[model samples]
Target: MLVSKSAIAAVLALSCLVLVKPQVADAQAQRARGASAAAISYEEKKRQTSDIAVTIVTSGITCTCARFAEDIRDIVNDLRPDGLRVLPVLGVGGLQTLEDVLFLKGIDMGVVDEDNLRLLKKRDPALFANIEQRVHYITRLYNNEFHVVARKEFKTFEDLKGKKVSFNLKNSQTEVTADAIFGMLKIDVERLNYDNNEAMKKLREGEIAAMIVVSGAPQSALSRFRKEDGVHFLALDERSLPNHDLGAVFDNYLRARLTHEQYPALIPEGTSVPTVANRALLVAYNWPESSPRYQRLAKFVESFFDRIYQFHDGSRHPKWKEINLAADVPGWNRFKPAADWLARHKGALQSRDGRTLADLRPAFDQFVANYTASTGKKALSPRETEKLFIDFTKFLESQVTSQSTR
Candidate 1:
């Protein structure tokens, strides 16, 4: 064919595009299919199978929620209670876990922070009103420490004033907690939203002055930091600076400490960083007592409480040792089935044999009684009582360790 060089070049270019168009379209189509598959609702997936007895919506794979859920799944699998099956599904985090339990079908339970419920009530009263009645807690799980990590130069939380700080993803537990905490402190800062890994990167790169992480320690994200990284935890003190004059806001959190033992790389030996913590709750939708779902959940609750000892024997996440199935979670109502179960087995559940702080109550009361009877005076102060209880608990824990080794 007789053709000018320019015309030939143009023709070849058009031919190349024509050949590439189908490949690009095919790639896009494949991606669309994959996304659609991923987006399939949990209900639809559940309908495709008849085996799943209960599905728990937890946080990302790296979170404590995921590990706790997996442990429950394992326990259920081992016990094989009437062929019941447990499925743990990973979700966005605490906020999403709450949403999933409220709206998503096939989500029988969720792992959520107790403070999230309070936040919802404070931030969106209408929505909280609608869901609060619908949802109830199974039990209060372990505490998630509020980790405030900053460069060594920013020794105190006040030092990060007006600097960029990462609160992690919006609606995450970290973000919600940071909002409440920073609001209480009245310390203004440029708030940043990034995933855990990204926030850590920005903090290391000095793009952000500090990052708040609300998770079970040793947070894998913070664990990656080396001692030379110059990252240190900001202490949230009740008597001074960080938490001083916080008043009612302080009631939402418990005074907690992050020990060097848990994160030797980020913390110095024999020293601890004080911080606030929120308890994670195993919550469930309040299914009617007459429904099959309610019965299934009740059965699951029974099995879980019955075999909780297995979780405490170092077979699962260390946090399991801290779970107090009988502990009262302030401002939240227990699920009816769980409440009834606790009521029926009150003595056993409250006994020293269980892994709960309540186990020490009887001894504490006896000590108070004996002291008052002997001294012919008033009982010990609350502070003294707590100290004695703590000391007694430590001795009991040591005895448990000693016996287990034998």
Candidate 2:
């Protein structure tokens, strides 16, 4: 066989390719085996740790942290016997932390924003059981109305147009919520990132038109601003305020009115600080069957709801009484353990599976009416109020379970 130079080169190339094929095949086979083994190990690890973790994330150093820590201590104590360890997890940053944790496996539990439930569920339906099952409505949190306390001139929302405003931080829930609230009034809010103290300094120096501050009621800033600055409370009508959807985003919030008399210095006897209510929920995922601690914790939550008023009564705002455990608010269905306990004890215990929304309306409406009548300042005596709340919590357990079964 007389071969041309090209044919000779082709033969050499083919011989080399044949020699390398075994090495390549061996490498790929080894990689495949390694991958399979790694996957098995990961799955086993997940199974081992799936039963006994209780992690929590909170907005650090903020006002809510103190109360949340106290509330969770009681919850953890109740969850004993399951060997559950409650630990603080930093860097949740905001509501997105809830979504991030849902993607992680074997974690067992953590808290999240009730408003972000839709977004979280879209990522993993199995991760979150239902709107009511996987979540619990712990308390009603309020977003204190912080007005841009000017000397006297910055009185109206329209007056602040084109002016520089102070914000707590750039991406803070405070700023985002503020933008939504102010956006409705067509005010072009230019937020400058400064700490609360610095923001106040800027306002005093006339370097900023006003500052936005938010906290629960009986806040110190309200007193300081009123006493020193003689600030005017900016009024917002529903049509003029930002975040019309706040009512929907916050399950514990009520569309209540804020009159100026609440803060003597900030608002004259007649000033109104119109703002939306904000809610902070106690959130967690499913409790593993193997963890006895989680079961105990579930029972604690039920009992705590029965007596929460003892802890929150008369210390701060009277509005705490209005926070109900059984109210059917949008997106509270993510706290699976609490929901299960509520449903099982309140509704399903009476029947085989669970009660539907259709079965719960009449009772739910009565709850609402009674809750309203009980919460007003003039409505119930202290002892009567306590008993009413106890009944209300019981009803909420039933209503939520019934709604979820449907």
Candidate 3:
């Protein structure tokens, strides 16, 4: 058959296309295999690091909780095997931390003031309706004492009524609690917002009658001031606050006393100024059991509680000694994994390093006896005894460690 030149060229091209098909397929397969290997490696790395990681939001870098979180991350994240990773994030304190944990993605937990649990609910009932179900306490970390520094003439908290008072900056944890306390008590103080440093200057200059700071005791701002400075920590007693509802106050706050040991510059030896304190809580969102977040939190919980004693040394923050791992936080259910771990360890023996509460009583009593004899201070109450015993145990541990190291 006679064929045109164009038809012959088309037939030749079709034959060439068929011959190259297998080569194209082989290259495509090679590229796909390479992609699959890379994907597998990426997934493996993700499983080791990101999958095991849990992010915990803290109030701020300087916040006690952030320091504690750093302590956790340092111990928990095992680089060799890519073990449990704790990522600490800075958050706005008080109520905001709670909201961040609830709503922000990548946040597994938060450190918050316990009072904020109620305050947030009180502020927006509908918004955080089931917050109880949504958030759970891993533990109560430390006590944030309500500090009221006033002029010597203003001897009591009530004396500051109708006076200008600094609540330690706007929407700060100090201001939040101070506002709540004053608002609840019906005290009509003119509220001012200034950082403690500036407020302290203002107080000394008589620019403000009093300044309130809610923080762990021995706070630097208060510690720097001397009793000779004409400023004092106001006592909150019935005689001082005659008409206010002390019942409501006590109900909301934990009864506490600040001693000279905590703030040597302000409080005199053998003196304990009456005060109230709220708890700093490490809280976790109630992630479902089926979720990867829950698994990561569970691993973090195990590492935290098991090595809990690491925080109790005198070398660590003095506040670290305050945390009783098995101690249940008030008004909050513990995270399930934490509760389970405690349930198993806090079993019949109640073994904390093979020493139960009963085992420590005699040692505590003797220390108290020696302390009282030397300092001429009165014996502490049951609650105070428990807190004292924690300090005593840490002291003994440090002494042992020191002797061993030597």
Candidate 4:
């Protein structure tokens, strides 16, 4: 072939261009994959952070427990800077046992009832302390009265004495309150071992004269069963029960009404019966400040409180509005963070107390001033301000060393 020097040079250049194009393309693909892998790796590391992960274990699929679990799940799934993944696990047997196992297995947090949390701390202070700071009750869940459904043949709680009375579960809040109700009304019924399902079956079969149930309205085991069994929910005369304290375990118990509003069949509309309804405390183990989950969870909790009423109806119960951490249990260690945040953000938090997130607006304004003064910088954007506030709060939480219990 007749090839000139210029032609030869042109071919060499073309070949070089082709080789360079592929090298650039390969580098771009590698960078893209590296970026994707980095994002995936970050998320995986976040998931591996047991400190931020929350596992909610509950046996009952009642409105209160289920609703609370949904809230936690929403917080975890919500796309936020802090990584939080909530795992809701339904289990049988006991809360303490579940908590112990989760803690031993490196679970960061577990939501349980107040009584169970207390029992765990009482039984083993050291072991409880290890996870104590991590475990704090956020809110008091549904509280409804204890219903003693008996055959209409029995007129009063006393009239049902000496008969076989079935309780929901052993060592449960329901069972404990049942003991108090019977003792107070001077109703000496034999304590028969029967689960809620079993008790309902026995009630239908005439094996059990009366069955006691503790549950929220619109969806309670007893309320549901009473419709089928045609049983009467006997009203306890609150004045009758002696030693109303109920062995101190049920100190915060109230003379709740098994109302028709909640259970139309059991408590026909306007039919008010005296029963003790206790609140269920949604708890989680306290995590160290260094934990990633703690930071994300703290922010989620703040956001939850911000839109508190949007999700819950204030008409559910007067107590719903009065659910302030400082008010319900003034000395309660469970809601310390919530309480502190509420204090700092006074008007900003939603409550019947006329508080909202706006209360924190003043503090944030002050922060802007201080930040500007110290850094010689202009005010931060709203998003920047919020990020800074969250970081500061997390830093403060990290400084806290003691485990909380109340």
Ranking by lDDT: 1, 3, 4, 2
Comparing 3 with 4 on TM-score, the higher-scoring candidate is 3
lDDT scores of the candidates, listed in order: 0.76, 0.50, 0.75, 0.56
Off by over 4 Å in 3: 1-49, 352-406
Q: State residue 136's C-alpha deviation in candidate 3, in Å.
A: 0.9
The stretch of ten residues in a row with the least summed lDDT in candidate 3 is 1-10
In candidate 4, position 72 carries an lDDT of 51
Q: What is the C-alpha lDDT profile of model 1 across 187-265, one tens digit per residue?
A: 8999999888898888888889999888888777788889877788988885448445766556778889999888999
Instruction: List candidate 1 segments past 4 Å from native.
Output: 1-51, 78-82, 238-244, 350-406
Model 1's lDDT to the true fold?
A: 0.76
TM for every model, in the order presented, reads 0.72, 0.55, 0.72, 0.63
lDDT of 1 at 365: 57
Total clashes in model 3, counting residue pairs 3 or more apart in sequence or in different chains = 0
Q: What TM-score does candidate 3 reach?
A: 0.72
Model 3 local distance difference test score: 0.75
**Tens-digit lDDT string for candidate 2 (1-406):** 1113343234333433443458788999989978866776766656435444455554434434334544545444323223444555543323454543444443334433344555446556776656345444443333333344554587667777788887666544456456656654456867787766787777777888877654445445444564565355565544544544434323333344456555666655664656544544555554564665456456545654445445453553543544445555564543444565555555422333454322333443454345446555233344443444345445545555657689
- Predicted candidate 3, C-alpha RMSD: 22.1
Model 3 lDDT per residue over 304-331, tens place: 8755755655567688768877777777
